[model samples]
Target: MSKASDLKRITELRRELKRHDELYYRDAQPEIEDREYDRLKAELAELEAVHPELSLIDSPTVRVGDDRVEGFASYQHHLPMQSLDNTYSQDEFFAFVARVEKGLEVDGARFTVEPKIDGVAVSLTYENGAFVRAVTRGNGIEGDDVTENARLIKAIPKRLKGDSIPEIIEIRGEIYMRNEEFERVNALRSEAGLELFKNPRNLAAGTIKMLDRVEVGKRQLDIVLYGLGYCQPSVVSSQSEYHRRLGDWGLPVVEAFWEATGPEEAWQAIEKLDTLRNGFEYPTDGAVIKLDSFDQQDVLGATSKAPRWAIAFKFAAEQAETKLNAITIQVGRTGVLTPVAELEPVQLAGTTVSRATLHNREEMARKDVRAGDFVVIEKAGEIIPAVVRVLTEKRPADSEAFVFPETCPSCGTEVTQLEGEVAVRCVNIECPDQVRGRLEHFASRQCMDIEGLGVAVVEQLVSRGSVSNISDIYRLDYEQVVSLDKFAEKSARNLLAAIEASKRVELWRLLHGLGIPQVGAAAAKDLAKAFGGVRELGEASLEKLVELDGIGEKTASGIVAYFQDERNRAIIDALFEAGMNPKAPERPKEGEAVLAGKTFVITGTLPTMKRDEAKALIESKGGKVSGSVSKKTDFLVAGEAAGSKLTKAESLGVKVIDEATLLEMSQ
Candidate 1:
């Protein structure tokens, strides 16, 4: 067929697919059978392939397949995202109410109480009544742009319902994956033999940040707008009115909001929300209580970090008592010793609980937790299982005080507790426990990302003495690796290749992999960027290091202390001599022309670029890509069937560009 004819057919097919996408994703109704829809999508894809010039940016076929970006670029918020003050008890709630009333110079106060969603907080920007940007709340001031991912949420409108579109509007809300969807995702992971996420929140957070927008779309993530950031042509004067207006604008707001006249009424509302929380599709950790009147809110103002007119009344943590069978100490990758409570197996929060983290010596002392005591345990944020308190009344009469170990449990070496630090750590770097922890941390996603290097492999290597230090991993022969149980030749080769490839990882990863105290991923990046290289970082003085952004005295001291240890210094030397890249990637100069006036949504796997890299490329070019797709998506650079985003893009008539097109545009 001629190119013109093919283009015409592709356009017709795209229009048909877009209509179906709107029917399925936006309306939650499917008019066509799955097979029939697939055929249409396949035909369109074929036509586009034959007439490459005809492929537009809003194709339905772009949702599921390939294109991947390297990483997200930083997006500064128009308005700073502030956290709300938390009120844990009735007294605290009352105090908050009193404070708000006093600030407003009123004898009484009214509050709007709504369920505090247990999900990732995000900001959505709309321009000319069309969806523009969706960003994660990163450090309050800056956030990761996730517009494509956000567009996948059917609840978030791509276009305003009425013609009365505000020139610019910012809506703040929670993006959550429902419990049922979380279960489905977990099931898929389990089927794929992958580690299951601890909870919906973690899964949602990880999924949204995925380089593949299609993967995020498949998770059935949803959003509910709870607050307004900046609204031009303000539609409402009070918090209650804002909710009503948001709902009227076809945005998903909280299901119910209660107007409490005073503290007593507020507490009552809180109790009501807690009672009703179990019935909701998503999880809520608490209730948000905010002054109802906008004028009152203005009068109350805000603190540097939180608003004085609003407070979150966190519910009491769920707790269940179980017998503490024993106390054990586990050394972390950094050699920090942590105490674990071995409990009699009991079920809590939909999982079997046998171990709970005691955090450190300070926490143990604070709670006065003891072995042989009936301890109340709860999952912190319904994720990490933790011992909350001890039931003194139910303590065994023969029980003795649980003593914190003074020595490394694995190597039997003396443990040292640093001044002003809560954790007591083993000084022996070669301790068996330390080796296992280090290996695990090294293979972690944020580190070397060595696929298939799980706890079992690390344990086998440690137990057999196949590997001792981090450097030993590079020296592993194929035969030695394959000798372990469940290790096939192919698996062994893959493992070796992964380790070999890991040597090329950036310096920030190497810094984090070192397990330095107080140096997390963010800090590692800062250190790497500040020092330029690991060797320089190792030799830098604490004062000089502390001068860097986000580097505090404690972290600087920790870095200095780590390097001062001859053993750690030797390990660094060995790794450096082993030919691992120890330098940070050079920062790219911000581009001026590329991605200008164009927005792209990356979904599924791409042949090139990690998600962050793709995001950076877009931002460097002066264009913005968001986590979710909305009416703002000028282009959805779909790799695979980019899931809900593909559907949404089709529904909104946004262009769905591909990786090749994206690359060409970037040039």
Candidate 2:
């Protein structure tokens, strides 16, 4: 191509890549897949190399994309946090190794290969061997301060362990969500009628930048530190040595690593990592190969964007082409209609893939998925099956787009899409599918702890018209239950007894079981602690709800809306009449409640009482229990082997108390 054409293409590519960078980094949304983005960047780099004069200094190829945004203080790094150059092809990877060898003037230089964790990059700063702050990798040079949220991750030690700790250091790593945690959080969001987070990476990116520490804590983010940024003493001399030092310091590091002689061995290691990544708790999208010797790395130097010593080889997502036989709509507990693509069964990721989530109506239109069209499907985040794209070229001549129904399939209710929302929901409270899901959730162990209320039993109860709502569970007749399909006299009696016992459970359980939007188990506990009883909580204003630690404006409004609904009010009233009185925590008289309005963190094994017992004692006296120690912590109850939390409390000057002292204070 001529210089003029190259310039035109480069201009367009720069503009496009910049938009994608904004979507991916600052906004936590990406329109294209990682490989596609890489291809675009790679093309621009080639074009720019051909015509260096056409390349501007601020081009995407020469600089790291900025992730900085509002609501966070910018923290300038002591050393720049650079990104790694990525390649999808093995030949390009070998080329990178060849370049490294030529630059260092050496053959078969040792290398370190480890899984490239798919997560948000952050730098953790330690001062005098104590964790001081956490900062995001915002434009490499400067980042957002997220110390408060980072403290909530239990895996991150407040103080470095082992000997020879650096006086001051910036520990670099990726903050990620485990697959189990991701599914759990998505379940809660689905229950709350909120749009589900698409993947763990996006969720983690958004979560770390959240303004509310309380909300951040509830989701449970974790970290894996492998990169070294700025060290005071610069103890480690190699990548392998740094990893060893990280492990000794009690920092979470990559589960597996491979030392290689050169690119051939590095590729083998990458292949091995790919095979084993499915069993890992965290998401590993690819493998990073870095030159082992720190001296060699320094000598080779780096570009303005990435290091010369390292490269990331991203693995292509496993995909299979399947015929989209039909599209089905599923009504969730919150009445949100999710469109699912029913595919002709094809094997993918060790499972027979018959269905994939189209997510919602908007996604279907964006992808233009049609019923008769062949579609490419892949496991999203190695968990959910999703339709990637439609095979439009091979489409049936008479194929048509999958039109989302205006009414709920489960019920004849007309669906409504709320303003500024993509979800088309069936607002019918009595939708059969929704009722079944709600009943199942209310009876789950996390909520009311009702036993023998499995899906089959709930299905039987609903189908028989013996139970319609959560309130119906309380009013079930023993005779009616015994006569059900699988219920015997003994099982029926146990279930009835369990139902009876649930009435006297802690108030938080009842609150959670009620299925208020945005009110998960954690939020329910906060609400129970603040309001004491369901009746009191119902009468509290939105302002009062928002005043609670974890309860944000959206959650507060959800609570208010739940209470304002006359139907929900009637359910509560009915529950009260059915001998249902959830036991609120005993409130002490003003002078006697010495621990009132204070937060305490319990650590180590106590002399007599267990941690839960100590927590219960504190909560009973109007105090709160926190999982971690912070400046806001009024007291740290210490005992035998009170590890990092005790050290943190001492550092922050938070008062340390023994179990005996706690007992005395309560008395």
Candidate 3:
């Protein structure tokens, strides 16, 4: 290629890399695989090396990707949170070790090897044995302060325990979601018709930065502290000692740790971690190898972007080649048609994998996946199984393109793919598969908290034609339930009693269980609190609904559309008729609307009440509490150490009030 062409290609690569950096760091929504991203970065680095004059100081290769976001206060790190230089090749890893050892003028430097968890890196600060702040690793220098959300994570302790606590310490670690928690959260999302999160890492990253602490608390996030950032009166002299210190403080630490004398032993440790990581609760993508001695690490030092004392060896995603027997479409609770690949049993990532997700019709068409083709399936993030690629050369001679069904396989009703959407849906609400899905969702713990109404029982009820719709559950006869397979008299009574008890559940649960599109538990709670009951909410106008907090135009429209549907209205009427009187939230008195028709944004630590307490108090008196302050905000409830939101509010000319003033106004 000519110099001009190389320059043009370099420009294109920089643009692409910048875009991907935003997606991966700020948005937590990466389109390309990690290896592909690494390859692109490496290519850019190589091209820049060849043409030294073409290199830019602010290039993705030189600078760390910033994860800082608006709405949260920025926290300057005590010590810069630098990233580790990583490689997929063993030779490159060994070269890294050689560089480290050469810098220290030693033959074999002692090192520590631990699982490089695929998670959001964070720095937690503790002052005098008490946890004070948590921040993301944003651009090495500063990051968004996420103390409020971090406080809710049970794994993060509030105070230090055991002996030899430092006056001030900053613990560095990764915040991640467990595989089972991810699955549970996805199941809820799938049931509620919300888009499923791609992986545990993305979900955890997104969850921690969420403005709503209540919503963040719902998703379980775990943390593992292994790195020491900054400690006053430094006591630990080695990496192993640091781990012990972290553990002594009642902090969650890495599950696996290995000591290695050299690069070869470190590689062996990494291989062992690869074999054992699948058994870990959280996802581990690679092994982080660091110099064990603090003195050694200090002597080696770091570059502008990464540390010279440490490097990460990323393991390739575990994959297995399997025969694709067929492609099957499964109808979800919301009637979305999902195509699942049926594969011949093959061992992958320590599990027997016979199926993988094809994602959508667009993905299938893009990949040209066909039935009877030999396909490579990989466990993405070591949690979700997905078809990585099709081995076209090994395809059968008569292989056929898997055709998406034009009609719902369950009800034979014609399926329709909505414009601007990839999901093909069976809109028939009464479709057997959809019914079973809805029944299960309505009975889920997050919904009605119904006991003795698991998947098997729901399947039996649906298959026996005993339950047709959500309301049919309320009408199930005791004798009919008892007659089902394996159901004794005691089991029948329990099931019936549970169904009967569900009638008195919270209004939010009923609203969530209704299978409303785009409305999850949080939205349901907002709606329930604003409108008091389902009947009143159903009768609300779009203008009125949009005026409420958390109710956007699209959600208001969905609510209006739901109520306009005569079938849904009939279901509501039947529910009421069948003795299902859900408990409505307490509404404010007519004279207590002092803060009525106003938007308030709360910031910083309050003198008496917590943020959620303040939010609830505000909501009770006919006022709305928003997550972020803006020009539209009527008041900024400023407290101690009010951060960026307060400054933004002042600039925007929004009124600032103390918590005491807020209390006075509300009264």
Candidate 4:
């Protein structure tokens, strides 16, 4: 093909691919088969390879498909995305309506009720009918720049479809991954031996901040614009008109929107939404009620952080009464002791919940939770299963007040609760519970990433006394591992290989693997970046550590106390002597294109590369991968069977890309 013709063909191909992407990712309707989609992608890749000049950054063939981002830059919303005040009872709802009416100086004011999507809020800016930027509602003023990622979302139009496009438009909406899509993504991650995300919303939030644009292109994220931020050549005079016009601009508005004339009608609408929330593909936390008139909205104005014109009526958390059969203490990787309430198996929301976490001694005391007491359990954010309240009226007469355990349940060692902390912890480094917890943390996906060292293996090693500490994990023999139940020669070899591979882990991973209190993966990275290696971190004074951005006095004290422990010091020495070389801190060089500030999320199946391969490539370039898509995701890497992520990418208008193009760009 001639150079000009080739360029024309490439543009045509990209346009066609973008259309297909809109249908599949944004609209949740795919007219083409997976093979057909792949064929089109392959053709685009071939053309782009031949005429690299025609390959644009926003090209469908060039984005990362279905990879997660590392972190998000906080965006302060120009108009704060303030949460609305809510009421669970009819009286409060009526009172709120009366208050709104009184404040507006109107005898009767209509209210528009929309589903409160249980997702992250984001703002999208379009300039001259072309998509320009996307940002998360950080503190409600400034947000991370996620323009490239947002463009990948098929649901969000790259260019206005109609002539009514505003010169400058800032659209506000929720970015959510559907329940089924979240499950599918997590399942795929599990199959790939990666950590599963907790829920759809978190996954959505986590996916949007990725730096690798190619990875963002893959996840098929979506968005639904609900409100207008700042607009030039304004299209509407009222909030209701804005909602009506949003559909014309090819933006997805709330499914059920109603304008109620009074409190009764608003309450009725809220009730209807509550009942219908379960039917929608995405989860809704509650209903958002806003003043229908723009003039009236202006009259009511806003608070320092929230708008007086809008209010979010949150739904009461789903609660179920279950008998507490037993109480058990579990030790976490960081040696913090947690109380667990084993209950009679009860179905909650959609899943069977048999246990609920009792967050700490303080939470238990606050709730007056006791053994044999009938308790009400609820899922916090419909994600974590937890106990909310205790029913004193249903308490058995013989039941006694539950006391926090004074000793480690596994090792019979004394446990202590530190001052200013709610968690009572087992301080013994060699305690069997502590050892198992530490080993599990060491082998976790975020740490050393040993593939085969699952909870079963860790349990076996602890029970058999084959491993007494984190360092002893490196000393485990293949013969001993194979001799354990459910072990085979091949499995043992693979486990050993994974363990051996873990020895060369970076200093950040090593620090996280240490299972230090108050030190999370992010904090571990910060510490590594500051101290260079574990030895240096161990030797650093509390005052020196507290000077770091995220590390405070509490965290500093925790680190110092951990290093001072003789047993911990010995374990560190042993790990150092075991041929492990902690990586030195890498300083960001001047003008380095090290994915300076970006996040990514990967979804579905890539055609040519394994997920890990793509992740390694992104990380090598100084970018971070996350498990879910969110307003924060800079890119969504979408592939075959790309489910809700595509929809979320579309709804949020996150950038979506394929595999071959990602490889070419990485070079």
Candidate 5:
């Protein structure tokens, strides 16, 4: 982007984020999901990072939380609240312990492991063995004084029970809503004809932020003190001692904790914590491992972001069995139709599981999942729920195989699956399901990003026939939209303004929004760079596309085939006709080809750049990124555990390089 355009986008992002913060923090009402909000914040941070001079002082990245809500008086914290670095793999968790040991210059290190509760962090202050006040962790430096709200929690003691309590001390921990309490609250809301809470964490957060103390009390929120933020006279020598003091003082703590002597033992403790996770009264996403000794923690110190002595070991999602009631086909942003399993609601990983992604028909057939069959389901990474396998013993003898649909379920158009691909796509762009999904995708943070065009709004457009195709978005009549439910003068104008603003989108975003088969965010960027415009791409032969870095033969074929249809080309023309002229791609510099003939594979989490960023960097430097490790792979950019890919590369005799080495070589 040009300097002016970049500045404009940053300004827009700031405005949107501030509005969301108000809804989330003050009103206890969130407009977008957490993942969506994270995406926007990430984009804003990236833009600021790229253009340092353009960064605003009040940018969300530089700060922790938004300003305190009007009703809550702000309280100052003695110590800045810190967040723990997260790891999904056991190898990574062990690596973290190794780092701590290396930093402390010790051979064998002891650590404390406990459940990392999924809840809002709060600070409690005690004076003269009496509970003085409690505050939400607003921005680390200070917090919102939610004393009245915190007082409602029955678990929090008004006075200390033991003489071991210090005169002046502050304890930090989680204020989580118990799973039963969460259900009760939701049931009450349902009886009251109110919207049900999305998740336990959000419900807990919303409950704390509520101005009405009575409402907060009704939820029966609970608190568990974990660590000391500050103390008048140094209280404990280690984390284990601190927990002992908490238990002695009659303060609520975690169910259990393990003391480990080494990395292997620490991992075993983490595994033990995982076993205790699903059985807990409250939700837990991972295990928190902390250094036992305060002196060792002090020696290890902390980064600007997190403490070096601790790390979070996240468990792979929990699995549970449920009946596959039915299989539903969903048309994605791209015309690809995906099979989703309708399940008999069963509790798993802190939330009720109703549906699971079958991924594609191929996966469905591989698992031999059918309606009326009992299946094991797991949340892959505790986010997307997926069907793991079918129970052969429980399957009815009369149960038949699931027939993969050859036609679009919504519009009855014949779906086609291309050679060398699993995705079965609806060729008709005019399919209502495709149109709605595409519109939602186009307005997504990664695409054109028209704010206010969410799933609900898109549903209204599709159902009312106000918009039937992508180009119809630009032609939305103001009067027609305002006639739809929930739309008033202000919202109608705002949505129209957003739609108008999306016309000036980047070429890569436009390409991604178009949803070409086998083309994702990265492939879209590659195609955009190789071709000046959609017309140029539409005319490009397969040979020209295959020559580009990261553009595999399969992706090249997809692009060529996507444009082969007149309906697809017409949509491109219609977009231009509607004034949404996307910017052309900026070509790479002439002489910056340091990694000309290299093929790289990245695994695990990198120390600095993300995998996508690394891939982009390598591609721009005239190198290529392969999905898997093979003899053809010239370099494997290994990070941390590096996982099975690194092992495969090593066995295949493929050269491996760290991020540092790769960066040095590129330079």
Candidate 6:
């Protein structure tokens, strides 16, 4: 290729990659798969390496997070939260270590290795003993202030614990959502007629930057402190000590880290960390190794983009070759249609990889996935099995693009993707699969606590036409139940007794069991306490629903829409007729709420009461139970073998109370 053409191609690649980076970092929307983006980036890097004279100063390789999202009050960082250099192979990682050694003029330098968490990076500021502010790592030199959102993370302390806190500190951390929590959030979004977030990292970035703290609080987020950005009084000496102090100060710190003395040791640690990534609840894509000593880091210094002392060893995404045998559409309870890939069973990431989510038709189109085509599948975070890309070389000559069915496979109803939504829906309330799902959820332990009601029973009852809706479970005749496939005379009687016991549940349980879209257990409890019963919630105006704390406009509209459904209203009538009438939340007796104006940290095991029992007692009397001890904690409820919370409470000079004292105060 000519030098002019090579230069032109490099310029075009930079332009395209810069746009992709903006979509990813600033807008929280990615147009292409991660692997494709990596390919383009690799191509550009290779071209620039060969033609060093043509390398532009403002190339994508030299910049970090250039997209400054608007609407955030930006603050200039005291110390830049720089990006890390990524290496996809072990050889490259070793090469990075060699460079570090050469730059420092040292031999067998110690390194700290930990999982490279794939999430939003933020800078936290602590003043004295209090959490002062937090900001997103925007454009490296400046960031968006997100102090309100950061406070909602329970893993982070509002106030420092123990006596080791410095006068001030700037901590760097990654705020992330667990894979399971991300799935749950997507479920709620689907129910609320909102678009599902493509991945966890994007959701983390969006959630942290939201203006409304109440909405942020609804979705629980967690964070783990990793490094120190700026510290006053020069308190910490090493990376390992920083972690120890983080835990001592009642902050969430990553525990999966190892110390290594050389490249071979670091290589072994990286392999072990890769294997352990699957077990972590949060997503991790690679391993990051940094020089262990702060003094050493100072000596090595950094470049304009990333620190020279640290390098991120990205695990070449673990993928398996599989054939897409068939595509099946799953009908969720809210009637959203999701496609699942039925693959020829293959091993991936230590497990049999037979199925993966296609998300929706839009995702299927973007990936160009089709039935009978050979494809590459990867576990996103070693948890969510996703089809990363297609292997077109192995495709059969007769292979055809998959046609997503336009009709409901279960009920034969004509389906359509609602306006502005990608999910195709049956829209048929009488669909048998939907009925079975609703019944299953209504009787689950978290809802009605109905024992002896399992999936088999629900399926059998639904198939036999005994249960048509949630209320039909209460109307089940004991004599007819014994006639089912698995029910014995004793078991049938016990099932009937259990059904009778479920009638006296609180309003919150009934609210949750109704299978209302966008309504979760916590939301049900809040609605129950605010409006008292289903009748009140159903009849309340939109203004009243919105007036409640934490109930957003979308949630308010969903509550109104659910009550407006004729079929749902009929089921509620059936519930009332079957003697399952629910009442308002129970009110505590006047003046008995002695635990007000105090925060108590409970640890270890109590002899007299279970943790839940003790927590209920405290909350019923207006006291708050905290997960960790802090200087603001009024008392620490000490029990047998109380651990770090106890030590922190003692060091902070907070009062220590026994179970007896706790019980006495509640009384």
**lDDT scores of the candidates, listed in order:** 0.75, 0.84, 0.84, 0.73, 0.78, 0.79
Per-residue C-alpha lDDT of model 2 across residues 185-277, encoded as one tens digit per residue: 888755432346667888899889887787887998999999988888878899999999999999999999999998889889999999998
Candidate 5, superposed: residue stretches over 4 Å from native = 1-109, 114-259, 262-283, 288-316, 380-382, 526-532, 536-541, 583-667
Off by over 4 Å in 3: 1-113, 116-240, 246-255, 258-272, 275-316, 381-383, 630-632, 647-653
* Stretches of candidate 4 exceeding 4 Å from the true structure: 1-103, 147-154, 189-194, 210-220, 361-372, 391-406, 419-422, 439-513, 520-533, 545-552, 574-667
- Give per-residue CA lDDT, model 4, range 61-124, as digits (tens): 2121211123444433434345455455678677777888899778778889999886667788
Q: In model 5, state the lDDT of residue 94.
A: 74
lDDT (10s digit) by residue, model 5, range 1-667: 8988888789778756766765555434555544456568778879999997556322433234443543466666767677676677877787887898889788889999999887888999999888988887774545688888888988899888866667789999999887788788777655432345666777888778777777677778888889888888887889999998998888999998989898888888888887777788888878899999999999998875578998877676578998999999998756789899999999986668899888898898888889999999986323458888899899998999999888999889999998856889997878888788888777765567676677777887789888877888998878976876677888788878989989987788889888887665556766776675888998999998887655657678888998998888888888889998888755447788788768887765679976657877898897777655655679999987565567667677889899999999888
lDDT of 2 at 192: 31
In the range 1-667, model 6's lDDT, one tens digit per residue, is 9888888789778767766776677666666655567788789879999997555322452256543443467665667789887777888888988998998888898999998898889988988989999988876756788887888998888899897677889999899998778889988755432346667887888888776678788897989888898888888889988878888898888859899999999999999997788888777888889998999899988865689999888787678988999999988777778899999999886567899888898999888898998888886444457787898888889888888888988898999876756788988988888888788778865478676676777778899999888888888897878987756898789888989989888788899888887676656877886777888889988998876544557678989999999888999988989998676665567897788657787766678875556767887886666544655578889887675567667777889999999988887
Between candidates 4 and 6, the one scoring higher on lDDT is: 6
Q: What is the lDDT of residue 66 in candidate 3?
A: 76
Number of the candidate with higher TM-score, 1 or 3: 1
* Every candidate's CA RMSD: 19.0, 14.1, 9.9, 18.0, 14.2, 16.7
lDDT of 3 by residue, 9-108 (tens): 7876876776677677876777666777778878888888988766632233225787876458776687879988778889999899899888999998
Return the TM-score for candidate 6, rounded to 2 decimals. Answer: 0.54
Pairs with steric clashes in candidate 2: none
The per-residue C-alpha lDDT of model 4 at residue 393 equals 98
Give the number of colliding residue pairs in candidate 5.
0
TM-score of each model, paired residue for residue: 0.70, 0.56, 0.67, 0.67, 0.54, 0.54
- When 1 and 3 are scored with lDDT, the better candidate is 3
